[model samples]
Target: MRTLAVTTMDPRHRVLCRIRIEGAEEAEKICLLMGSEVAPRRQFIAAGATELDEARIDI
Candidate 1:
């Protein structure tokens, strides 16, 4: 498991830092806990997806 600090994005962007999930299984558990909420879990997932997209482009 690894955690990363993420800040300094556009101010309009939501900031979710130090959210540590080990793998897909752990992420699933988190999703289950979150349970259909839209504000935060969606935001976090969107942020992660955005980061992954950016990383793919960089590579």
Candidate 2:
């Protein structure tokens, strides 16, 4: 499998949630599950700078 990502950020560009997936659909689903909107469609070419929304209880 490959990696895709979805994220949410506050107006200040602070990370709210970041998650991994195999494709775009999963990314959106993750954001929904977290009650957030997906960040600008992004590239997850590598796990360079991703962090899960710290406010989330799942992590």
Candidate 3:
């Protein structure tokens, strides 16, 4: 498993959320579980703590 970061643009919450994940697949899985609309690239950016709507695996 690789370490990944995820960022979210929650307009409803009016804030950006960040999280560290294990891998691309795992990130996607977690997004689905959370009902978050995220892209592979966004996961990577999020993991890197970069500003993005979505991303992929950083590791």
lDDT of 1 by residue, 5-58 (tens): 233344544456454555666666566535766677776677677457564452
Please give the CA lDDT of all the candidate structures: 0.55, 0.45, 0.51
- Model 3, residue 5: displacement in angstroms? 21
Q: What C-alpha RMSD separates each model from the true structure?
A: 13.1, 14.3, 13.7
- Alpha-carbon runs more than 4 Å astray in model 3: 1-22, 36-59
TM-score of each predicted structure versus truth: 0.26, 0.21, 0.21
Residue 5 in candidate 1, Cα distance off native in Å: 35
Question: lDDT for model 2, on a 0 to 1 scale?
Answer: 0.45
Pairs clashing in candidate 1? none
Best by TM-score: 1
Ranking by lDDT: 1, 3, 2
TM-score preference between candidates 1 and 3, better one: 1
Q: Compared with the true structure, what per-residue lDDT tens digits does model 2 show for residues 1-59?
A: 32233322334434655554556686764445344444432333223246655576442
Position 36, candidate 3: lDDT: 50
Over the stretch 1-59, how does candidate 3's per-residue lDDT look in tens digits?
A: 42233233444434444655546666565555454555755665567575543554343
